[model samples]
Target chain A: MSDTTIKPRIEKAPVLERITTALPIALVPVLAVLGFVAIGDPAAWLTLTVAGLAMGLMIFIMASGLTVVFGLMDVINFGHGAFISVGAFVGFSILIWLGGWTASSSVFLNLAAVFLAILVSMVATGLMGYAFERVIVMPVYGQHLKQILVTMGGLIVAQQLIHVFWGPDEIHVARPESLRGSIVIGEAAIEKYRLVAVGIGVALFLAMRHVLKSTKIGLLVRAGVENGEMVEALGYRIRRLFLIVFMVGSALAGLGGVMWGLYQETITAHMGSEIMVLVFIVVIIGGLGSVEGCFIGALLVGLLSNYTAFLAPKVALVSTIALMVIILMWRPQGLYPVVKAK
Target chain B: MKEPLLTLSGVHTHIGPYHILQGVDLVVPKGGVSVLLGRNGAGKTTTLRTIMGLWQASEGTILFEGQDITKLPTPEISRAGIAFVPEDMGIFTDLTVAENMTLAAARGPLDPDRLEWIKTLFPPIRTFWESSAGTLSGGQKQMLSVARAIIEPRKLILIDEPTKGLAPAIIKAMSDALLELKETDTTILLVEQNFSMASAVGDTVSVMDDGHIVHAGEMAELAGDARMQERLMGLSLEAHQ
Candidate 1:
């Protein structure tokens, strides 16, 4: 209370910190501008930007859960892709069963089919996640090497099971008539479904942020990420909190799976494994446990991939890796590293 | 003089290959401060941790209100009206002070009057309520750690090295705060290295050496007798001065 008392070393002004935080978000537009300059075509640029945004949002949905799980549990679950694939297949089955709803020209019926698919997929994947944690992840709490091996084995088994059930061949999925077309604005054309994906992605991000920042469970989770022992000492069951987080994370991956499957208009047993590469890239670029970092990292990868594919089709595959390297050189701990005591 | 609120009898703990706690017998009496003192690696920390069930006692019993609690989980131990502030202070640096305090009030929402009382005890908890705890000074974080333990009333509070690595001014402030806490009905089992701080707030004292209690008696008697302090702690109060 004394004025002469030494102040706890004054941290950088909050405004400066805010600006640094906002800097990554600014990169999206800056990259978009660079794309416009390189292509020298306004219409193509507009189309690619929307496509990139949609792609980024979907990747965010998938990577968000992985980062949270890693951040809090310190578990590297290599089999997360299993949930994605399972959700896609389960959701696809429901869609096929609701043929009447998908075939209907009415928007309400078409939306209803997609909603049901998302709901069923989330539930199925969430339950799968519970079993996965109890069976494969619980025993190897602090053993990183075993976690990687067991989870990878789990992925392989899940993929094979998909083949056994859905057959070895790729299955074609048709979009509902209501969602199949694009809306034209001047010279730029944007797909309606991609716009819808963008809406859903933003909604999910806001909801997650609100929950993590405002709720008691979110507080415990964030605290658990820093020190699980402390949370337990404070009389909360950190294990139960982690289990709930793992299930929710798996459910989100499922929702992302349904969205991505629809975007590709094709479902295959190996689709989740295939996307795992990109998801891991997003997770690494985002910083291990930070949701905001994951969101920005996803968008950056999305835009870079789209822009590179447009400008130089051959370099598209390595664009994300290249970007990650450059980013790492600039900030070794990823774009927004959570400051945790080592 | 008062009945022991908690009692640990012949507790032994094994952490991996190291038998850290050979046998720790401690008694925390009701409604006063009891200081646990010893040199580094004396198993002082292991004793507190065992009571909180962070490290399970391999042998012997821990009783609370004469009920066996030797095998309860850490959360269960805490829920049974005991709070532990670990040696590291255990402040979640990523979270705001308010969030850390909120999590510690495990029973429910913080009582408004209690929150106000805590704010007066530790001003930084209120002053930096919205700032992430990582930004706090070592002393402020220590205050927040103690504030968290008393966020709600508990039968016993276990605090380990609350003044470690803090400035002298801050240590005095912490000592004063603990002295104030001594006036309340809360029972504190404190682990301390600073003799001045220990003698300032301690009602009773237990000294450990190589994982066992070597001496136990009234704090006033030990503080007044230089020969006893030297024999038990290898250093007297005057030596620190």
Candidate 2:
């Protein structure tokens, strides 16, 4: 270590810019208030809000990986949904095996069973993601049309494989003892699982933020997303960084799949593709490769979907599309757009 | 005789159907600045890029420290101790200045002495230490780009147009920074258009036209002679010779 005294840095706060950045976050609260007013009943609104948040957080988990992958290597893996389905099925198998623990009256045993299933599912999905990147994604780098066609083909094959293993039949699952019922607050009965999901989602969002903002790996990821070529020139192998990110992203999707399957209490081989519509919406709305953007977009879509489904069932079908259109019109590049190299 | 740190022989690069660098030859001497000067589309940027291994030369060899790096992947070329600051500066705007610097140092944490020295060279780096890179002014961004290149010790640096756009004040500061950087004995292959800045820091100069080096000699020779500037800047009939 050499001796050198460095000058201290002076902090300069730019208030206007901070406000501008924070405005998108305010949209969640604004939309929630609108939702509350539109529904006009505290109980119904609260229940729907919890459910919407849970759905949003789950979608954030899934879309988070896609956005980063899209942003970093510019790979459009339509095969991403395959990992989701695989995760759900894997977790479903584990849950079925641990049925006694899940059915047990002890909350500890129930949570322990669910945790084990999630862990096993994450590993299965993470490994599958690694293989998927090497086998399917590696060949189609920078070729948009081929990436779409090949990954979609991969998705189809994965679905077929799922059928081979889990059979083509839709699998139903029962919630664990502690997670089965809803908590009554005043007049509203909020599902315990929904609340738990919201907590996990918020915690995950915070954790992800910390990683992206604090860690060296996260810094490399953020750098890789913006200018991968530059990242390579700086002496780090970006492809390796990108591979790690791809695996982690896939693992996250796997986690999301498990959560989503449990939430719906049903698992189908085609479930991943069916949810792709919402995932794509969140990715597009969040700005490709932006985790924060994905989170907010997920929440907005989830909240709006639930609110619209409650307020106007007919409008709910097109609400997500309309939201995307409106957001695109407003920001064009999506919220929190990554400044790409020209 | 000054030692050659890098040498490119008969380098040619094709991007899709367009030929960017065609039959280019260059040599960067160790321990000082070698400026690659050219007008628009003279393939100065492409030459720097080819040397950095961003774009693989379709034909020919690029030997850095005598190691043939013609077909090496960009990351490996960089890992061989060559840093590149592209024309775009390639700053990750979303990341803070501190984060950008953190990514620059490939091996462990940055050296405190070097960090302090860089802060002295580019004052804006300290001012915007925690600020998002996107928030910086153009001059500050350029400073950050150069600072990033020197964040760690490297044998060679390939910089493309560090003074493309800026006020005279910023250019002077950049010129002063490069002059001071020369004292540390880092080999810099700078692609630039600003003649004054080029003349100020360059120990050796190579003028390019139509993807070929038209003139190569001491920077003083080009700086002292007005006729050479007009002859090589454009309409270099001797490029064939």
The model with the greatest lDDT is 1
Residue ranges of candidate 2 with Cα displaced over 4 Å: A1-18, A339-342, B235-241
Model 2 alpha-carbon miss at residue A17, Å: 5.4
Clashing pairs in 2: A67-A289
Position B114, candidate 1: lDDT: 95
Clashes of 2: 1
**Candidate 1 lDDT, tens digit per residue, A55-158?**
99999998899999998999998999998888889889999999999999999999999999999999999998999999999999989999999999999999
Per-residue accuracy of model 2 over A4-98 as CA lDDT, tens digit each: 22223344568996787888899999999999999999999999999999999999988888988898889998988998999999999999999
Model 2 chain A: worst 10 consecutive residues (lDDT sum): A1-10
**Model 1: DockQ score:** 0.64
Poorest stretch of ten by lDDT in candidate 1 chain B: B118-127
Candidate 2: give the TM-score of chain A: 0.95
| Docking model 2 quality class | acceptable
Best by TM-score: 1
